[model samples]
Target: MHARDSLDPSRSIWHFIAVHLRRYREAHGMSGQALGDVLDCDRSTVSRYESATLRLKRAHAEIIDRLWATNDMFTNLVDFADRADEGDWLLSLAEFERRATRIRMSDTSVIPGLLQTPDYARATLMAGTADDPNSALERRMSRKAAVFDKENPPRLTAFLGWAVLGQLVGTREVMRDQLAHLIELSELPQVSLRVVEKEAGAHPGLDGPFMILTVDDRDVAYTEAASRGRFLMDPFDIQEVAVRYDLISDIAAPVGPSRALLRAELEKYS
Candidate 1:
C-alpha cells in the first residue's frame, strides 16, 4: 500500500498539521517536489510529513510556514503536538505503575529507575537527556518516589542481569550509595531483588529488557527505546514477557547471595 493512502490521520497527533500542509500544497497547485524545493528537502520527506510518518523540524517548519503563508500556525501546532505526545506517554506510564499490583522487571544495563538513588538518577538523566536534564530528572524521580509512598505499593521483583551489577554509572561514591540502596530495598517484604549471573548463558531475556505489570488480574508489558516507550497489551505478548521474566529469575542469585554480592561490590567502591 502507498504510505500516504494507508495513513490514519486520526491516530496521529501531527495529523492536523499534515492535513493542513497537504491542503495548502494542493490549493497552491504545488507538487511535492516544488514544496520540497522551498524546504530544502526532497519529495519523499514532504510525502512522509504529509503521511504523518515524519515530523518537521523547527527550521523546516519555519520555511513551510513562510512559503504557505500560514503565519506561525504550522510551527505552533507542531510544537504543541510534540509536547503533548511526549507528556501523555509519560503520564500514562506513571499512572500504570501507580495502579499496578505487581511489577516484574529485567534490567540488562543499569539499575531500574525505581531502584535508583537521587544522585544516580540525576547523573544518568544528565547523560541521557543532555538538554534540560534537571527537568527530566525531577519528573522521573517524582514518579519513582510516588510509587513507593502509596499505602499499598506494588510488589516488585527486579531481575538484574549480571552485567548491570558491574556497569558504572555516575561516580564510584554515587554507585556505592546506589548499591547500598538496592541492598536495603532487597530486604523489604514486597520487593524481591535477584542477580542473574552471566554464567546462566544465553536466554530469551537477551533480546531486551521488559517489564510485566499486573493490574487487577490483567498483565501489561512495557519496553522503552530511544525517545519512546511501547506498551504491549496482547495476552500472548504479555505472557511471553512473563515467561521470560520467570526464566531469567530462575537463574538469578537468590536473595541471600544477591545481598552478599551487592555488599562485596559496595566494598570495592569504598
Candidate 2:
C-alpha cells in the first residue's frame, strides 16, 4: 500500500488470522453464529474478529480449530496475534518514507494521498462508507503530514491524470481549495508534479493508479482498487511497474505546465 494507505499493524495480524478463520469456517459450512456458539462468544464478536476489529484469544482459537477441524492454522494464528505489534501501520510507512531517497506516485481519479488537501481528504472520506468518516479523514491527513515533516523529506515525483484535476470531489469551493493546495504543494523544492493529459493517449497506467516508493535498499509498489489496496514487494513486479511508470512519465506534461493546468482548473471553480 502507499504510505498514505492506513493499516493497523495490530489489526493486520488479526486480519490475517481472520482470513484463515473465514476460510476454515466456509470449508466446514459453518455460519458465524454457529462458530460463535462453539466459541461461547456473541455473533457480533465473531463478526468483529473476522473483520479484524478484535483479536482472537488463544482459547477462542482453540475452540475454532476444534470446531472447524483445522490441523494447526488456528494455533499458528494465535501465536502470530500474540506477538503482533499495536503500532499504526502509517507510522512504519512514515519512517520508511523519511529514510527513502525517492518517491514516485501516479493517480488516475484523484490526487495521491500525500498531496491531498484537508478539504479534498474530507470529501474523499465522506464519500466512503466508513463507520467513522472523521477518524478516517484524520488518519489520512496524519499520513500526509509525514511527507512534509521538514526534518528529512524524500524527493517526490507525482503524476496525476488530467481527469483527476477535473473531478469535483466536494463543492466547487472545496475543489477550488484543493486545487490551490495542489498548486502550492507542487511548488515545493523537493516536489515535482506532472499531469498526464487525457489526450496523451492510452498507456499502461490506464489500468489504475499505483505508487513506487524507493528507499536506499529496495523499492516497493502500491496499487489500489475501489475497496482494497495492496503492497507489491516482489522485485520482478516492482521492476515491471517501474518501467510502465517511466513510460507514463515520458508522456506527461512537465512540472511547469502541470502546475498551469492545475491553476486553470482551479480557476473554473472560482
Candidate 3:
C-alpha cells in the first residue's frame, strides 16, 4: 500500500535507493517505526524516504550500511549520484519541488516561476530566446500542477524584489493577471508571498535568485545564473542559501502589506 512500492528503481539513483531501502528493511523484519528510531526521524519521514519523496542523504546511506551490514553499497550509490554532472539538475530540482516539505525562494529578477501567470512565463521565455521556448514555457506553467495539485503540497515562502512587480514582462493584461495571481496564491494557507520594496535597497538577494528545499530533514539549494543553475547539497552550501533567504525575508514586506502592494501593482495595468 505504500506509494514506494510503485516506484521504478530505474527512474533515478534516488528511486533506486528508495525502492531497495524498503525491501532491505522488510527483509530484516524491521518496522518503519523501528527504522525511524535508528534514523532519528519519525515514521512518516522513513515513509517519505522509502517513497523517494524525500531525498536520501549520503550520511544516512552510510548509517544504513552499518546498521544493515550492507557492505557500503548504499553509500557508494549515493556517491555515484552526487558525482554525476549537473546535466540532470532540472530533473533533481523537479523532484525537490514535488516532494519538498518546505520551499523557500528568493528572487530579485522576475516573478518566481511558481507564481508566474501563463502569459508572463511565455514573455519571459521568449525574451530569453530559450532553446525550446514553447517547451520551456509549458514546463514553467506546469509546475503549478506538479507542485500543488497533490494531497499535501509543500509550504512555499517566496521573497521577490519590488522591481519584479513593476517591471513589465509581456503586456499590460499579462502583468495584471500575473500580479493578480500572486495575490491569489498568497491567500493559500501554505503559500507566503513577501515583496522586498526598492526602498529595502541593497540585499543578499540582489545578487540573483536561489531556492532552498527542505526534504527528509535535509536542505538542498539551487542557485541560478544567466546560463546554468547549480544544485547545492552540501550542508554548508545549503546553510549559506538558507541564510541568504532569511536575510532577504528579513527585509520583505509583511503578508498584509505585501498583498496590498500586489493589489496596488495590479491596478497600474488597469
Query: Model 2, range 111-184, lDDT digits (tens) per residue?
Result: 88788888888888788887788887887777677668758788899889888998889888888888899899
TM per candidate: 0.67, 0.67, 0.76
Question: Which TM-score value belongs to model 3?
Answer: 0.76
Per-residue C-alpha lDDT of model 3 across residues 96-196, encoded as one tens digit per residue: 78767888998888988878878888899889968998998788767767888889899999998998888988888898888888889999999999999
Q: List model 1 lDDT by residue over 60-95, tens digit each.
A: 888878877788888888888767744345664675
* Backbone clash numbers for all candidates listed: 0, 1, 0
Name model 2 segments beyond 4 Å from true: 1-95
The list of candidate 1 runs beyond 4 A from truth reads 1-87
RMSD of each: 12.1, 12.0, 4.1
lDDT of 2 at 136: 77
